[model samples]
Target: MIQTGEKELKGIIPGSWHILVKFWPQIRQRKLLIGSSLFALLLETALGLLEPWPLKFIFDGVLLSRTDIYPDILGFARGLSPMWLLSLLAVSIVAIAALRSITAYLSTYGMALAAIQVLSEVRSNLYSHIQRLSLSFHQRFKSGDLIARVTYDIERLRLVTIKTALPFLANVVTIVGMVVVMFWLNWELALISIGIFPLFAITTTNIVGKIRKETNKHRTSEGAIADTTSETIGAIRVVQALSLHDMLEENFLIQNTKSLQEGVRSLKLATFLEGLVKVLMALVLALVVWRSSLLVLQKTLTPGDVLIFVNYLKTAFDPMRQISKQIGQIAKAIASGERAIDILDYEPHVRDLPGATKAHPFYGSVSFEKVSFSYDPSRQILHEVNFDVEPGQQIALVGPSGSGKSTLASLLLRLYDPTVGGILIDGRDIRSYKLDSLRQQISVVMQDSVLFAVSIRENITYGRLGATDAEVEHAARLANAHDFIMDLPQGYDTIVGERGGTLSGGQRQRIAIARAAIRHSPIVILDEPTTGLDGASEHAVNEALNRLTRGSTTFLISHNLRAVEGCDRILYIEKGEILERGTHPELMAQAGRYAHLYRLQNDTNEIEGVKHVLEA
Candidate 1:
């Protein structure tokens, strides 16, 4: 189950220690909870420390003859006569039993409550940070990977935080308290009992460190599987349409296999480490017994003292084993900490300039001053382009695919900034305005306008949240969506399926248009708005489009030259530069690239007409 690469990693003691030290702030907060938890552990450690004294007293004072033992055996049994020894023994046994019950209840609950509180805070913060990352980051990371990190990897921390880790720490303090008391009573016996610790540390570091790294790999593999599943399911339509279901399943199985292998390997290594701890405990016990017996015979130590040391030796390994068991959890926690920090530390590519303020309500005059852009630093997607939109004017951008039409629209919306130049709204550089304020001045509809899975009313009013019912209806009517929305079973209340899949393509486009219409921004950017519609549907939508475009600074991007012909001016773009710029009739009259394309379309239509005439 464990990968070979992970198994070969040498244990680095200092590095792991530094990782813990660096995260001391997180530890301190947990320690405050651990302190509350420590209160209960104090009673448990005290009960354990007190436990040995009573037994030592019983052995020396009553069973074996010793003068000094009387001071430790607080309650008297011998003074009450022959019935007294049995009564005292029974009371001593009951006292030890009662102490254990109080120890269990107080220590476990206090630690459990504290761990959960920290987990709650961590999950909330991590979730909030994910939301703050830009849209581009989300596009690059798989949905399933992000989901698994937040839910699965984070849950591993939660499991260890409450159940395994804090308890182990509390017990370490308990074990230290036990050792201090044991050495105070008899240093020679304590030293003999503790000799196996260095060996235990060696064994634990080798096995647990290897296993901890593998556990992280298993978590990563699980994320890959989840990512594949999420992607497949999200695009279920494409998968079914292309008959890729079996291929996707095979891919998922490959990732799942790796996860399963790591999980099994981690389990095996954990079991091996636990068994080694038990073996070390036995060895230490045997050593303590052999050493203590010789002291007893030489009269350096009494039989009573030898007996208490034997019990001490048996339980002394508990803390070492406790720490060894928690190493995997601590390692996983460090891994989670690294991921959460990566997100919090990353700087956003776009940040508003210092002292930036809101752009006042737009006057619909958008100007590009030698604007240029590139998604990557090495290649330019747009050349230095200059243009200006007169207030309330309609301008059209005509181009083939990859001519930077969509990128131009994106810049206007402030989805991205130009690499080499600034965009000015009215007379001000857009960068000087607050980001949200800059975006608010423009409303847009792309070729594939997205609608959420919600009611028709909700879809239309998405552009302006908190819009009144009357406003929602008005926007729908303005986009020519009111008649169809009324025709649906529930009128405005009709629930649109996911991405408005329940509606026809043209219907979905209209709903998206209505959403854009509701914004009522001064600048409207329509990017290939009616690309795939039927002739009659395009005519119907164009009627609503005409109503929406009026009185706004409308910038239209379309592959269809006819769609832009009606605009006041058209910019025929080729590559990164504008090939021509004029009103549609002027471009047609100029006999350039625009005129050539127009003639081809006219000839094709006439040819189809001639064939029909010949057939009749």
Candidate 2:
């Protein structure tokens, strides 16, 4: 969906600002607050320039009495048109303070609104991009890490983008404004006050590079911790069953310690840079005061000029410190943007080739021709697999644990394409149909049926999303789950806890079958759907399976030959090939692998049945 070209990868880091510029279109929709932020910052800088000038008025008029002095200091200020100058200075100072507060509020509120609007869009886009990525990306990356990047890392960027950017922008404007005011006051004093600019520039340059590097690591480490915590929580059941809770806790603790170390390292660098800026301010102010004092004593400069330069020096330091603090936040935002972009750039391995047509509803006929596949190429899992099933026919696949029975189902679903051959439905290459449409015509009930955390009614509705409540209940009845479901106090409305943990294996499996049944597709697949059920439960599930697959082309994979006894045709698979094929009596007469497997199961069933009889 992203249509990423060559420059994109697993983590999308924009090499240039042009890639980032693409976000402005989405951002512009919230233009009012964004424009307000810029206007406020600019205005704040303009108002800040007036703050120091009022201090110059105070020094020249009320405090210093610039004209001349009397015998005593109090006598010096005693009467001489000082009232008019004093009154003007007082009003100006109060007015400047009020203006400064108003500008700060405007800039802060407007920028806060803009940051929230823009960052929300970024988070949503990142999530959509991750969801669109092919399974390969998910297989290789840790679930915890992706979760952290989406949740924790993105939030970090929010803090930097909204909390830091506004002040940093305003500070830049203030620095420029201070330079202008200094020049207006006295060009020579302005030059002297700013002589340390080159030194500060070099210092900021070296620190920005180092701070960016450390901040990236620090953010990544924090993401790792969040990832580990999520992974541990998701697998808490497995951890408890395996008695691995302590081991997982230890692993999480190690990651937390690493995050702590990185956080401290980042804070240490920030503190050092802040202190260096403060010391630079102090030295520059001392110089301006010393030089202006000499001029005043020589009757060339007034004391007001000296005081104004010292105040300007202080004003200038705020911008530099703001800049230093923001550099660290900028580093993390860049890292987050790059990470999200990488997933957005990936291409899925499977896609329609040129000139492919959308597949229509499949007829019952299905065939596999010379289909060979190897998820790992070093060892082929399916080799020259060939098979055909008639319309409304039932095909059984009997195999040992590692045989290619499951692989056959996967190929039919087109989860992966064959390396050397193709599968067809109604004489058309199955891949010709769009992926979703092809799967829609086939319904599968695997060995372990997955039940989402939802009500039984909702779970069954997953089969046919728009199916009516009556249809779902009817499907549940056909699957033989209606009785147990009604036995619960809440009936179909009861929530099936995570993976249907509250239900027995038979109940979950039966509900899963109901899901497939409600879809009423032309082809049905059952992969040992009743593997772990008890005898009575298995019989009920098999009865439901019969009802679900009635008149539908069906493929059944099972180790128990009894389950496949009614199949029109049976294929015995070994390793990756069909070692033998026939009906029940036909295979039994042959006395080959299928017969051997059948006899073994029959004998085991006889012994178990007799044992149960004796116990009864």
Candidate 3:
């Protein structure tokens, strides 16, 4: 079994860079999208830097009575008048805004499309991997929690990619551009402007770091809330029958309260961090302004220079504060990725070996050679058992509950492999066959015959996908389900509710028999097929089953002794061992455990029949 708990959970929650690196395969597939978005981002950043330049020209050239252009280092506006330069600068601002708007849209839309594509692939892969995992792995985890990981956690990655991941990258690029330009304007003033960066970094690290930690806790709590809700709703019938409304409500509320508390704590830290960044940026502006004013008076700097320095400082600090706010989301995406990746990383314990080949047609000659099994090693469920059955024989397995009857069927279907020894068909080990081909050759009608929420025709055809309409109706007729189905308003097209809840137990069982009959496999396993049914319903289902299992190697597992009379042979099993094997009359003649149990049930039924007669 794939083990998971605190240790595995902690192993998944990797750092931000780790998340990026781990998902690189998805990222690598969208190179065109990434390249387009990056180009647009470059355009937008370049335009943004030009945004403050127009104001610089207006300040130094128009307002200060200068004839040369503000940035005369290029000497491009040597012949232009002050008014002309001001008008040209105004035009430049409008053009910059228009270009920036177009590029911003492109970058934003492209990244969003890319992120959605990558996350969709991730979700698909997670679901596929989860479906292939062994039953033991699934039994170890709650279905609700796994659902949350597939839906909720994977969704977080989508939001983080578009909302947090892309934006964070853009901000880093903008910050770098601003730093290089600030130094070019005046190395001395630029140094003074960025002196508070160390302080800003320290404050953001302290608060956002805490927020990230709290956000991780918040995400986990939300998953718990999802799990609780799923469990409660899935079993709502039982909850209502037992009046467990208040108890479930209390449990759900506790998880919701914890999630709310963690969310609030993260918000508080993020808000405080944003405020601290603003305060520090204000102080940095004051120091830059004071020093720049002295340089202007001393003829060492232009007034436009001060404006550019101050504007760049604001631009740089603004993204710092934005980063502080998104720190929580970044942490959440990383945590979600960890949970999602856990599913994808799991290796199924029951997958076929590399050289395994498809199974040939089975002749139904099965041999269990010292087969031993256990779900848990300390408590063995099936001990060194051996048995053989010929083709077209109906063998009944009669045993007390938990005597390894169902386990034997599961091993035959390869839902799990045996712990020791091997099961063989036609003297070849079953493990040598490919999993799908082996399972497809055996038809199973479980106690609770599961039907999909689809058309009656579709449900029956599931046994053999793409079966013709005539073939489907033929199978239904063989299972004695055709008459009632044809009587319904929509006939074969009638839609069944989930698990066939709209139909009676007998109706569902007959449809399941029809599904199995359509497969026309050589081997059949009927596990308490008539269980939990009234006498009339059991009689009807048994009639259907008789037609379905004719001429097939059948294993009938039942506690009802009356149901086993037609079986060709009977095996009496107890405490993980088969103690007696014979036909019904032969077992009764031997007066073994099977005979004793059968006589006791016969006496009980006689008493129940007499009581029913008196009540009637």
Candidate 4:
């Protein structure tokens, strides 16, 4: 199995640059949209540079009557009266603003759209990859954390890419354009105005690391909060029954407070950086005004030139100031991106082999030839015990909880590969078959049958996509689910609550059996199918299970020995090793552990029945 260690989780956090590199391929795929957005950005920057020129001309040529100072581009305006010049400059300002707004809209909209599309694809890919990861990987992580990574983390990346990163890019471009123009106008003052940039860089660099660290902590806390919420809500019935509301609320408050603290810390760091940038900008502005006033006194530069220099200085520094403000958001995005990238980079431990092929139709014969397995090296789940079943045979696996009964069933379904030996189907190594194809031939009805929040018909048809309505009803009938389904408010169209919570346990099990029956697979694995059901419900579910397993090779993993009495063979496992194998009668004759446990269970049931009769 692919192990995720604490050291690995804490190691080598990816920086912003690394995040960009990781997502470059997805970003590259939308080249045309990005290219157009860049074009618009450049155009907008050019327009911004022009915005100040009108004021410059109005100040020098028209207002100050220094028409002689007009550049060649505006020489033609010198011949015009002051009134006409003012009118033209006013018109030019409006025109420039209008055009700049248009290009800004185009650039922002284009980039935002592209970011949404690209990240949507990333989200989809991440979800698909999560689904394909080994069961062990999922077992190691909280479902809520995974859900947060898929949904909340990706949303953070999208929001920052559009709301923060895109505008930051445009501002950077504007700063570059303004800087060049400032230098062309007055290199000495431009150099002096930009002198504080090094400080901004230093301040940002120092604070960003702390901000990113805090943001990562905040993200983790949020994931923990998500986990708490999902767990609490998923088992709300149990929680309420046990009166754990206040305790769970207290736990949620703890996580929420931690998240709030971390988020505030990150924002504080960003605010500190922004404040430092503003202070540096003010210092630079004071120096520029003082120095340029002297130049104005010496007549080396016009007041209009001074105005342009000041304007360029502020405009150029604005992007840096904005970046300092958004640094926290950017850091949070990078942290979220790394979480997503870690999942994308993970290799599933149970994926198909290079030469694997789709399995041929199964004959339902299965063999565990000295098969041994472990989730990890230190804890072996299944010991090397051999077993074989003829086509259409029913095999029962009885064991104490955590004694590898379910692990054997999981191996048969290829949920995890054996660590030591090989499992074979129809005399061939199970690994030779593609995972989907091999799994498609075997159907499983877990102890807790999970159902989506969809209509009853949809849940039944989920067994075999595109199954006809007749087939759905027929399979439902086979599982004894059709009658109750028809009596529902919307009949088969009735929507189930999450995990089929709306239905009785027996109803859910029967629907699950219907789902398995619809597959018509040659092999079926039942893991405590009738567990936790009332006596009547158990009888109904057992009848349904009998119909579902008819004509298929079945593996039954159940605690109720009476339920497996009719199986062709019984394997009694203990501590990952099967110590007894025979029919129920044969095991009873052996008077071993199986018989002892069965007798003890029967005695307990008899006492319970007597107590119930006395109470009645």
Tell me the TM-score of each prediction against the true structure: 0.79, 0.78, 0.88, 0.88
**Weakest 10 consecutive residues of candidate 2 by summed lDDT:** 1-10
Q: In candidate 2, which residue ranges exceed 4 Å CA deviation?
A: 1-25, 28-33, 58-115, 183-278, 295-308, 352-358, 602-616
lDDT of 3 by residue, 112-178 (tens): 9998888898888888888889888999989999999999998988888788877887787888888
Clash number by candidate, in order = 1, 7, 0, 0
Q: How close is candidate 4 to the true structure, as a TM-score?
A: 0.88
lDDT of 2 by residue, 51-167 (tens): 766566567656776644222643534465767767766787888778878878887877777767776787788787777564546778898888877888768766876777667
lDDT winner: 4
What TM value does model 2 have? 0.78
lDDT of each: 0.76, 0.79, 0.87, 0.88
lDDT for model 4 comes to 0.88
lDDT of 4 by residue, 1-616 (tens): 0111222223324476677687788889999999999899899989988898899889988888998788888789979999999999999999999999999999999999998998898999999999999999999989999999999999999999889877877777777777788788788898997788877755665676667678879999999999899999899999999999999999999899999999999999888877876788789999999999998899888898888988887777767756654655666677888999999999999999999999999998999999999888999888897999999999999989999999898888888999989999999999999999998888889889999999999998889999999999999999999899999999999999999999999999999999999999999999999889998999999999998898999999999999999999999999999999999889999999999999999999999999999999
Candidate 1 vs 3: which has more TM-score: 3
**Total clashing pairs in model 3:** 0
TM-score of 1: 0.79
C-alpha lDDT (0 to 100) for residue 529 of candidate 1: 83
Q: Rank the candidates by lDDT, best first.
A: 4, 3, 2, 1
